[model samples]
Every structure is written in C-alpha cells, then in structure tokens.
Target: MSASSTPAPQAEGQRRTRRRTLALCALPVVLLLVVALFAPLPYSLAQPGETANVLGRRDGKPVIAVEGAQAQGRDKGRLMSVTIAATQPEATVRLPDVVRSWFREDRAVMPREAVYPGGGDTKDAEKRISEEMKDSQHKAVTAALRQLHRSPKDIHVKLRLGDVGGPSAGLFFALGIVDKLDGDGAGGGLTGGRTVAGTGTIDADGKVGAVGGVPLKTQAARRDGATFFLLPKSQCGEASAELPSGLRLVPVGSLQGALDALKGIRTHGKVPSC
Candidate 1:
C-alpha cells in the first residue's frame, strides 16, 4: 500500500511536468502569432470607392464631350465608371488587416508589386498613374472614333473627371463618346436605359485589358446602383470572388463586346457571360 501510494504522487508529478513542458513548447508559437498579427506586410488594401457616370454631369458639366456633339444619356440611363480606394505604393499594410480584407466582401488584398510597379517611389507611382490616365483617354477616344468609322481630325474629344488618375475608366469613357455620337448603331442607347458600370484598360485597337482590384470594384458598382457590370475577360475570375448581388457580370473582350452586352441586356438578346 505504501509503495502504490508513493508511485501515485510520482505519476501526478510526471503529468504536471508534461503539461509544463507542453506549455513551454507552445510559448514561441503564441509569440509568433502575435508578431504576425502586427507585422507590416508588403501588400495593399483595395476598398470600395466612388462611382461616376460618364454620361452624367460632374460639377454641372459633362464628363465626356465630342466637341459640339449632342450629349446623350442622363435621363435614358447611366454609364458609370467604377473606382476603388486603395493603399498607395508606399503603404505598410499589416498582416491582420490583409487577412481581414480577404474576409470582407467590400475589400481586397493585392501584392504591392501587382498594384504598383516596383523599383519606384510614391511619386513615380503617381506619375505612372497620371500618364496611364492620359493614355487611356487617348486610347478611348481613338477606339470611339474607330468604332464610328470617323477620322480623328473630324472629331475633338475632351474628357473631364476631376483629378481621378487611373486607366480603368477607359471602357466607360469610350462608351460615353459612342453614346454621345451614335446610339448603339441601332437607334438605341449604349446603356440600354439602365445603370451600367465597368472597369478595364482600353487599347486604341479596341482590345480590353485587365485591371487589378476588380473584386472591390464590383462592390462599388453594386453600391452605385449598377444593374450590369462590364469587366475584362481575364479578370472575370477575380471579379467573381466578391461580386455583390443584383449585379450581372458581363465579360467583355473589346469595346464592341461591351456595347453588344449592354444592347443584349436591353433587348434580351444573347450576351456573353464570364
């Protein structure tokens, strides 16, 4: 009986020692978790941002004009351009925020290099966005003129959207110009009398290019009352991740595809899906 009682205490002590050792082993892991939660990460957060209808007014003026071209839309429908609020090139996003962004429907996390080109400072990033904006405007106009089969010299295109810098608005800008000049080439408006929103980089040849931060842009589109969204074909998968309800996704490969999608939505015709 004495020997059995002595071993019972020894077993209890052994069990206590095992628990202490396990806790000691777990301490470093807990510390790492805390560090990870607060450590600065090389990523950027994309959040829902403002939307502007290219066919509508801003500051009591037209956002797009073909120079003496009779403005269309506003009452018929709205062609909205979606923008996303994101961390600048020089932002230090923490790991916790990045993880949180992934779970939030209105937010997204992107690699710093994916959104902003590397090997440049914040100023360089701004300059690049500015140049891209100007280039997108030119390409949008050129694509519009090409679609209309008109000479560039015959048309003077002027686009005003405040200090917004980004190339994602190109597709909407082209649509606005086309709507102002001609109505879907079928006596119908480009917007099909419905609020449409989209994002993509435009080429002079009418090819649409993928723009990042599409998931957050989709949230902005839905928030802005868009019934249809035109996004580049390449980023359809990304856009589908957090797409808000009541917004149909239209995958466009070019300027003409987007116009057809809007027209299809109006006429219930066959439209391409993402």
Candidate 2:
C-alpha cells in the first residue's frame, strides 16, 4: 500500500486509545443514570406536612366536643398539630429523589431502616400510628381532667380526628381540653387568645416526652401563624436551632409547666424559654 493511503501505526493506535478513554469515561455516566432511574436508595425522604387545629371542627363535627359541663366557646388562639411525611417501605426511592430532598430545607433524608424498621409493611406502620394516636388521646384526656381536678364521670370528652395519627398531638390535645374546661376562668383559658402550636407525647401524669420531626414541626407551626410553640424540654435544642422568625418556643417538662407558660403569655408575665 502507498504510505499516503495507509494509516500510520502510531496514529491508528492513538485513535483506538482515545476511543477507549471516551468509553471508560462514559461508562460511569451510563451506570449512574441506570442506578438513578432504577435502583432503590437506602434512604427515605421526609417533608413537612399539614397542621390541624385540635379544637376545630372536622366533617361537620367538633374535634373536641364536651358533654355534661358547660361547653366553652372557641378561643381566639389556635392549638395546632404538625405532621411529617415519610417514605413507606413498599415505595421505591431513587437517588435523584434523595438528592432533591437534601437540598430542600423543609425536607429531611433519613435511612430507610430508621423510617421503617424490621422491613415492616405499610399496614404495620398504619397500625402503629393508630395505636400511638389512641394512646396519646387517652393520655391527653386523662391529664387534662387531672389538671382541672374534674371527675371523668361528670364530664364526657370526645375527640374527633380525621385520618390523623401521631403522638405529637398529645400536648395540643391536652391544651385544647384544658382551654375548653377553663373557659375564661380566673387564670384565663390556656390559649389566652394567641395562636399556640405544640408537639409532644403526653403521659397520664402530665409529663411531656420528646417526639420526632421537631424541625419540620417548627416550620409547620410558624407557617400556620402560630405565635407560640410548645415542645418537650428534651427537644428544645433542636427546636431552638431551627426556630422560625416571629415564633416563640417554650420548652415544657410537664403539663403544668405548659399551663404556666400560657398563663404567662396571657398575663404578660415572664415565660420560660427553651
């Protein structure tokens, strides 16, 4: 072959080497695309969700209706419960979704195992949530009655919650009950005409316990126009770090402490801070 017509050996080798290098570089891109599209991530996305007023009506019925005692009028303030959305076990989460969640301030990325332990199914998660809700409601009612020094037999308390399940509403539920019972008494209502939002697990003894999703809950409370938020004392640090502007965070270790704080709000007294 003529030297001009034939490709040089070194040039051919160089062309092949360039092609190999391009292929090697493209391999990772192709693999990443595939994984991003199809592979399930080990983490789940959590985001801030809706807030509901415990004292408000739902489905044409009062959320917290009292029978036997004089039903108090609605307070000017609101007691809200915040919720967070978490990925279910059966749902598949991709890397792109996780990456998106990481950039969103209201969204949280958590390990799948941490969200759904023991590979539990969706039904199991629902059942667990329902149990927590029921327990919280019971505790809240009991605590409120105890704090008011009222007998459960003399008053009937019915909680009407629609499709909401979580223990984080316990504190607000207790507050709502107390406000309903007190109704502008000497100490004034628990809310005292200011939007109050809170999240915590309450026991029968009125002790407040920490719950998860404090940061998201704080954001939700602030978005809902809550002037004050009550959180378990143990979660004060998390709440303080993410405290929204124009919202006051009060850390309470017990139900009485929450009441005292609210009274302070109403009376313009010095209130406890987180």
Best model number under lDDT: 1
Per-residue lDDT of model 1, residues 108-158, tens digit only: 787888888753778998898898899999999999889989788777988
Score candidate 1 by lDDT. Answer: 0.85
Error of 1 at 139 (Å): 0.5
Q: Flag regions of model 1 displaced more than 4 Å.
A: 1-34, 68-75, 119-121, 186-188
Model 2: per-residue Cα lDDT over 1-274, one tens digit each: 6555788999999999999999999999999899778798777788777888887888889889988898554477777888878878788888778878778888988887766655678898788788889999999999999998999999999997888887878888888898888854764566778888888999999999988888888898889899888889898888887678998988899889988888898778979888
Q: Which residues of candidate 2, in runs, are more than 4 Å off?
A: 1-38, 72-74, 116-118
TM-score of each: 0.85, 0.84
What's the lDDT for residue 104 in model 1? 77
Q: Hey, what RMSD does candidate 2 come out at?
A: 4.0
Q: What's the true lDDT of residue 20 in model 2?
A: 100
Highest TM-score against the true fold, candidate: 1
